[model samples]
Target: MDTGVAIFPTHDAIAPADVARLAEQRGHESLFFPEHTHIPASRATPWPGGRPLPRRYAHTFDLFVAVTAAVTATTRLRVGSGVCLVIQRDPIITAKEVASVDVLSGGRFEFGVGAGWNREEMANHGTDPRVRMAIMRERVEAMKAIWTSEEASYAGSHVSFDRIWSWPKPAQRPHPPVLVGGDGPGVLDRVLAFGDAWIPNHAPAGILERAKELRARADRAVGLIVMGVPADPRVLEAYAAAGFARAVHWLPSAQRGPVERAFDAFEAAVAEFTGE
Candidate 1:
């Protein structure tokens, strides 16, 4: 089981470069950053967590930019978007950005995508809330074509394009891993369709068994990436037993001090678990 770190790259958090370097030095497998292009002022969409959305959601850094910085600063630590909102962006532009990052990072990018929960925010991007999942699926398929082909093109219900040229195809063969994020029933179907992994955030207890059954039913070899986990050895063992390929723990804050302390604690915990 690989251990990784995920952070909300906010104005007050640790710089991406520093975190990347530290995580790499500490033997962490990956550094993931979450994305929120822009939070709408309208409070029509209730927070999925059942509370007011945090201010950090509005002040978050662009995930591609943050991940690019981290990749440049570290050689081995994988860089990922913990969960990028695929429904809100133009698939063509996103495809280019993803391919560029993969090339620049020496193929160390993981594309974790999701149909986000912000209805108003999706509305701002002209995306229909009712069809967000369908749109997201089409966008991901379109991006995959762009990443793998020199004269790539796509035609789908939500995405259609003529042959267009894009450079710097991903360093990783067939492009970086596409990890779908969600716990919905349809989400598993989508993952089996195209994603290389499934990442569910703070899943319910007994989720592992359920996910295993789902994978078995689909006959997919994709991994299960569990995010937002606490830094506890016992929890790690449980996740491992549950067949998690990777587990990501959150940094308490993005500030240097808190991030450093979190990394220290994580390293110790990982070491204790691995007997290193």
Candidate 2:
């Protein structure tokens, strides 16, 4: 199993380039950052974690910008958004950004996307929470078309556009791996439908088994990428045995000391568990 780190690149945290350089120096395989274009103050949608939304969400840096910084700072470490909110973005623009970053990063970009949780926040972007999944699906499809075609266009229920040419296609042939993030049934189906991987938070027991069964039926080698993983060797081993391809440790905050400690612990645990 490969190890990665997930961070919220906020203004208060360590710079993205520095974090990426540190992760590469520590021999971590990848660095993932979460995204929030902007946070809504309405608080109409309760925090998923059952407390006030954290300040990091409101001050997070743009995902593509952060990834670009990471790519510029490191040679081998893969860079990605832990979960880009595709439901709120324009697919054409997003496709161009993804391709640009992938090319710049030498194909070391993982496109992890999600239909976000905040209803009022989605509304702020002119996205309907009711049809978020549908919109997200259409957006992803549109982006894929753009990445793979010389003159691409999409005309879906939620996304429609004329044929237009885009340049500097993704460095990775076809496109970067599209990893869908969520835990619901619909989200799993979306993963099977378009995503190359399923990125879920640490799931309940038997979830991995169920996911394997679903993957078998779909005849897809769709990988399982777990986020917010505990810093335990046993847990890492268990997840690997359960078929997770990647496990990413989430930092409590972006402070340098805390982040360094988390990476140190992760490196030791990985060495102990995998003899790498």
lDDT of 1 at 60: 80
Off by over 4 Å in 2: none
Clashing residue pairs found in predicted model 2: none
| Per-model lDDT | 0.86, 0.88
- Tens digits of per-residue lDDT for model 2 on 151-221? 98899999999999988799998899999998876777888889998888885575677667757867758
Summarize candidate 1's per-residue lDDT along 1-276 as a digit string, tens digits. 998998888877778888889888888899899988898887888887887777888888789889989999999999999899999999889988998999898899999999888898899899999999889989999988988887988989889999999877888989899999988768878888878998988655756876777678676588888998776777788788878989898886557887888888877777777778
Error of 1 at 206 (Å): 4.0
lDDT leader? 2
* Model 2: worst 10 consecutive residues (lDDT sum): 203-212
- Give residue 58's error in model 2 in angstroms: 1.0
